[model samples]
Target: MTDDYIYHVDGDLVPASEATVSVDDRGFRYGDAAFETLRAYGGTILAWDAHLERLERTCEALSLEHGLSAADLRGRIDETLAANDLADAYVRLSITRGVQPGKLTPQPDVEPTVVIYVKPLPRGGLEGDPVWDGPATVETVATRRVPDASIPAAAKTHNYLNGILARVELAADSDEALLCDLEGRIAEGATSNLCFVRDDVIHTPTTDGPVLPGITRDIVLELAREAGMPVREGRYEPADVLEADEAFLTNRTWELRPIATLDGRAIGGGPVTDRLAGLYDDRVENLCYE
Candidate 1:
């Protein structure tokens, strides 16, 4: 986050302190932007294809065509990493609907504002330390997920006020906010995906609902399935998680973090979480570190 690092803004590399966007930019005024948070290990961006696919889907949902190809974005990210001398890093790529008429309705013609920035993170692999300090303590909040009907949940846009409100309700010591849908079904954390183990089966809220269909969540599900673990995705109540044998959160930054307690109940993670974490590490090691 320091000004010392270089940032890529609108196709040009600029010093972070000097990078600026117009006040009339639609992304700033209306949160009309889509973005992705990615992890890099040994100079390789993990799950590049999956992340790109998700970004494209989000852009489609917004109906804002940012005229930049995958290779163009990739080159920018590569230059960012190289410029910052970061082998292992946290990368954020954002594309905004450019300055438009100061009206709610977006214009048909679009000039996009694209930016890529990265910050160093600890090494991540078989022999690496977790980016998170310890198991997370979570609190179920009153803020319900915005229903998919209201807003397409698939878009990873800058309109994060919902998540922000959810976080504001979290306990002072809590690491995440678990949001339920209007129907009282578990949705996801403020920024991470939820997964629990019960009767040796993994359960997660279906993306068909308000869940973000996170790239990390999809990878974990596939890894569990390929490892012969039973996995189910559907609507699950908060009680289901309360009674789960093991629970964990997944995101690009955290990778995986066990839940130490939920709603003040100590339903800590166990062997199942350990196994899945190991599998995820194996994946990272094979793909990026090996």
Candidate 2:
């Protein structure tokens, strides 16, 4: 609740307290919205192109013809961040289907609602501390991921009930809930992507499954390969993760947080995890903190 911050709403900068979307908006009434969670480093939005690409993909998935280009959206984010004097921040950009008639079907003509908001965070790099207190405590939940057939796995939409329900099943002290697909194969966390190491090799769920092809996840894979570490992507069971030499979660915010335990069993934070984390930090330092 960044009450002191400024927010961009439909191209206008407004005080956070005044930022609002109408009740008639499809995004508010039916969750017809696409959003991106972005990380800003030294006032520069990290992977701006990649995040925009994914956001555009989500809008396409929702058929939400937001009449804004990447530059238009980026300007809004830049303006909001500047308005709040934010450099390192947790930023969010959303495009939703604007107010429409109360009907099940959507109309071809669209006037989308655009928004940008930010919350400051500690600097990220070799010289800065991590946002997390320590490695994450994770638990494998019974709530399975929604199949791609129902809702395309790649779409980062506002309809987060699936993730919310998964979180509802997490232990009170747990930091994350790991979700598996319908076939009982490991998928990903409610908000992050899961990665595990075994015998010096890294493995993650294939995007062909019910996994959200994460931007950070792809970047980590790139870093691992550049660091000469083995990487593989495929379906695996809970046993595979639990028995791994190490495990971790990745997202724009967390970056890379090693898993402390899975299902109350100790399982992560080894040499491999440390090395990959350092490599990730090095990239951030070179790209943003330099």
Candidate 3:
């Protein structure tokens, strides 16, 4: 997040400190933007197709004009990696609804604001370190996820006030904030997808509700299925998660993290978390880029 790093603004590489957007930008005035977070493994972006496809769908749904092709964006990311000498890095791609001064609604043909950059991953991450060897603690927040009726939950838009408010309720030592739907059903973590293990089966809330269909979450589900583990996707209540044998969170950053406790209740370690972690590592190591 330093100003020394190189960044891309509308396909042109520039210094991070120099990257700026107009105040009139809708994305700045209002959270009218969509973004995607990706990571490079040995200079390759994993699940490129899935991430790009989701990004495209979000842009289309939000009526944001993204004129660049996936291949073009891929090439640009590669260039950024090379320019910054980053083999393994955290990449954030954001596209705003663009500048429409004194207007709440964006112009029909306005060009979108594009910002892409790479940042150093956390310690023990992407450096062949064991980031999720042990369990972590999480807390339930009072804030509920914005219902799908208001805005598509699957879209990675910049309207993160809900998640931010949830984070405020988390304790200083908590790893994440587990948010529930308005009906008091478990939805997802603040920024990560939630998954639980019960009866040797992996259970996650269906994306039909207010949960982001995370790329990493899908990959984890597929890994579970291919490993012959039973998988279940449906609407789950908080009791279902609290009573589960084990639980974990998934995102582009940590990949997979085991939840040790929720709301002061201890969820013990299990073989399923270990198995899925191993499979995740194997997949990352053997990932092929197009």
Candidate 4:
């Protein structure tokens, strides 16, 4: 379907181009908003309930009104996908603090703006490309991920200039960039969560670490557990990642992608990574189309 298809704003389906908010909207001027990205496959949204819960959590963190219930939001997403005539697509759910007067304080009387947009999934390379047979090279950027004490990096908020800058550096030097905290401990990739398999155990940075709690990350962890693999969430140093048996990045768009190298060091797909990928594919197929 074309981009001109209707999107759901608040509770109504409206033209995509017409879905606009005021310049004084808190989300626009002050980055006061929360969002969630989900994948739609075969007319079903993957892990919808989880995504919505995270969104609600983000709103709660920001003290913004959600303006809708989880069930209502899911219904709107379903309707938006149908209106766009896309069974396989990407869903963006955004909740802004709404329009307020010229000040930093939020207007309690104003209702939050809730918008849902459907976009076609990215091309072959950005997602799980068939060429993704090995570990991807990762470079550590100069920019550090925001610590949770300052902004709670786990919240999926609109404040992402730090991530954007790191991604730019990665694009110029490496396939991906590994972020660290102010203290220089490994956090995660710019846009995706980091998962590495070492000695048959899967390790990822904890939510307490400076990284977003990615939905794909959770899914991978669940799949790993179901496969009877041990999963650990804790602090990981760059050296630990470089010496891992296998490594991959996970997110909504890309799902799971193998990383072949980090800073020119050689890393490739191992048995554990391959098994995890296979299990992920099976789970998605069953959950989305069953």
Q: Report clashes for each candidate as comma-separated counts.
A: 0, 0, 0, 5
lDDT of 1 by residue, 153-222 (tens): 9899999999999999987899999999999999999999999999999999999899999888999999
What is the TM-score of each predicted model, taking all chains together? 0.98, 0.98, 0.94, 0.91
How high a TM-score does candidate 4 get? 0.91
Over 1-290, each residue of candidate 2 has an lDDT whose tens digit, in order, gives 35668999998999988899999999899999999999999998888899989998998898888789878888889898899988899999888888899996998899999888899899987876788999999988989999999999999999999999999998789999999999999999999999999999999999999999999999999999998899999999999999999999999999999999999899878998899889888988899878
Model 3: ten consecutive residues of lowest lDDT? 122-131
Model 4 poorest ten-residue lDDT run: 122-131
Candidate 3 segments exceeding 4 Å error: 1-3, 122-127, 131-134, 288-290
Worst 10 residues of 1 by lDDT: 1-10
Q: Answer with 1 or 4, whichever has the higher lDDT.
A: 1
Candidate 4 regions off by >4 Å? 122-135, 171-173
Higher-lDDT candidate among 2 and 3? Answer: 2
Count of clashes in candidate 2: 0
Which candidate gets the maximum lDDT versus the true structure? 1
| Prediction 3 global C-alpha lDDT | 0.85
Q: How accurate is candidate 2 locally (lDDT)?
A: 0.91
Model 1 ranges off by over 4 Å: 1-3
